[model samples]
Target: MINLQWQSFSKEECAKKLRTDIAKGLSQQQAASRLRTAGPNELAKPKKKKLLVRFFAQFCDFLVIMLLTAAGISFAVSFYRHSSDYIDSIIILAIVIINAIIGVVQESRAENAIEALQKLSSPCARVVRGGKEYAVPAEKLVPGDIVILKTGNLVPADIRLTESSSLQVEESALTGESIPSSKKAETVFPPATPFSDCRNMLFS
Candidate 1:
């Protein structure tokens, strides 16, 4: 696949370089072929750690290990002296257990928050294929697919517009600008243009 400087290319040039028809888009068979070649358009989630593993990981801290060692030594000394009192060793072990539980709970909550954000960002896109528009999962989108963006719709993938009318995309996530950036399909940019200045393009 070619690494295109998409912003530098004209709308027609992009369509040509992608081997797609701007008007008709890719045929069903062509889209399927491309999908197999390009794979799904989604971020790969990190492999999740098992709950037991996560719980045990909390004890990997140096301080926790040292405390555990101290508790074990204290219990041994009490046994050697023929003393029945084990309160100090027991208290230390209890504190260590509580701390581990707290750490696990916090880590689980953070994982849940990240998962929620991913779910929120995953969106369907309206795409043109075989001269007809269809609402499709963003992950199913292949390169050269023509996408239609409406107000309030998330940009599903990085795309160069073939048409636009009063298009303003909120790119604060990427550019850190509070205001929506105006987009024009006819606008052409030079090579090496800053991403924030590529008014003709939309990024996911």
Candidate 2:
């Protein structure tokens, strides 16, 4: 694991420890090698269930199981009493199957809509490599890479501040605060300080 104590180190110290130039950032070749070793910088998405599996899961509910048992018993009793009574048992079984299918379809549609919304909210970033800046998807980021943050830009990854000029970050997603908090580059807090109070770090 890349356990960097970013808070305990100064800007120069961080550059030395990370073995990268602060102004020029990592060279293209170096960044590529690190990326291959560390893998993409992204959150793991939940695996979606297969459609058939999800549909069958609806029939596993307690009520559905009990209804199936009752239907079987009714059919056995009806067949012994009179031929017309057997039709009633068939009707009951049909209704249960129809209800289960409807429930599965409705829930599947809701899950698909949520996934579509998440795709729209994916974030991108601007980074400096070999002293040249480029716009790339946030997942392409790697450790020791220099990211340029501006107002209204989402933080692409957990980052340490090397330079800041009137930097203010909106951290409501992490801290639940309503206002954007001011940031500093030189302040080092105690190890036990709450995450919301760390003015020098930004998290994705």
Candidate 3:
């Protein structure tokens, strides 16, 4: 596993620490082993989800149950009245079925969106991993991972940049900026300015 100890330092400081550890009569492997044994360099495990309960929960919406009960009541009323309203019964039953189908479709769509794994399918990435460079899936990324950016590519994740040579991003979704915002790596105060003036982020 790649170890990322990003706290208590800037990017340059982190790089210098890696080099200094190697220069102190310790092999790269030994330095890496020591970092791992520290147990503070790894990303925390994410929470797990219950698949079976979630799958069953999808069909238990109040809309479908209410429609079904209404249809049953309609049939019972017609029967108790000794009336021959076959057409009316069919209409009520059809409404119940249609409502059930609509609920199923809506529930499934919502579930798929919540459970789907989001990723950047960019065929190329300037990625730094295991203290070296490689091309990998954007989904595999965690915090403190460094990625190089350029035009014509969506940003892979949120980052507190320590370097940028003219970074920019389209942030209409997050800030409703109505335009692509220019970015810099400099730190800013807590919500001190409007989106028009704040230029320190790159977001999808």
Candidate 4:
């Protein structure tokens, strides 16, 4: 399906651009072809770092490198002085190790939390295909599908509104505004309009 500045177009213009019938949506054959071309409607997950790699990354900070350098110099000085005490170098090394451990632990916990949230999110969306309404898996959605939005429904993709009735969407996840933004299918925004001001559109 066509991908363009949908927020700047009227509903009729959007339908024409996407090559979709607003009343009937896309045929099964068309949807299938578009799905293959677009791939699944999901964000790419970052590759997880190994625990050892993450631990080492913590030492890459400037302050950590400085502390390590200071510890090395202190050890060298102690060795030259023929002194048995290595307290200063040992303490600095211990602090750096502890900091790395804490950093690794926090990163691991955050990854687990994000995975749990992904599992809990909505997996399907209601859409019209071949003039028939179906609750299809969200990953199957293509650009031209006519999605039916309702209260509390998590939008499955970035969509242009074709119709609405007192629609007010919670966009805090995108705009950081707690207030629900009022939406209108007929409102065409100007070029370069901020996403937060695009009342005629919905985002995933």
What TM-score, computed on C-alpha atoms, does each candidate reach? 0.80, 0.81, 0.50, 0.73
Q: List the residue pairs that clash in candidate 2.
A: none
Between which residue pairs do clashes occur in model 4? Answer: none
Clash statistics: count for each candidate: 0, 0, 0, 0
lDDT of 4 by residue, 1-204 (tens): 344678888899889888899999999999999989988888887899988999999999999999999999999999999988899999999999999999999999998998999877747899999999999989899888999988888888899999999999999988998999999998999868888899999988
Q: Which residue ranges in model 1 land beyond 4 Å of their true spot?
A: 50-53, 60-73, 76-87, 94-121
- What tens-digit string does per-residue lDDT give for candidate 3 at 109-150? 786676564322334445665556656455444334566677
Superposed Cα RMSD, model 4: 3.6
Residue 181 lDDT in candidate 3: 71
* Alpha carbon lDDT of each predicted model: 0.92, 0.83, 0.55, 0.91
Model 3 clash pairs? none
In model 4, state the lDDT of residue 40.
Answer: 80
- Candidate 1 lDDT over 1-204, as tens digits, reads 447789898999899889999999999899999999999998786898998898899999999999999999999999999999999999999999999999999999999998899778779999999999999889999999999888898899988999999999999987998999999999999989998999999999
Tell me the deviation in Å of residue 102 in model 3.
6.9
The model with the greater TM-score, 2 or 3, is 2
Instruction: Kindly indicate the candidate among 1 and 4 with the higher lDDT.
Output: 1
lDDT of 4 at 17: 85
Determine which window of 10 residues in candidate 1 has minimal summed lDDT.
1-10
Name the regions of candidate 4 deviating beyond 4 angstroms: 1-3, 47-53, 60-70, 83-102, 172-179, 189-197
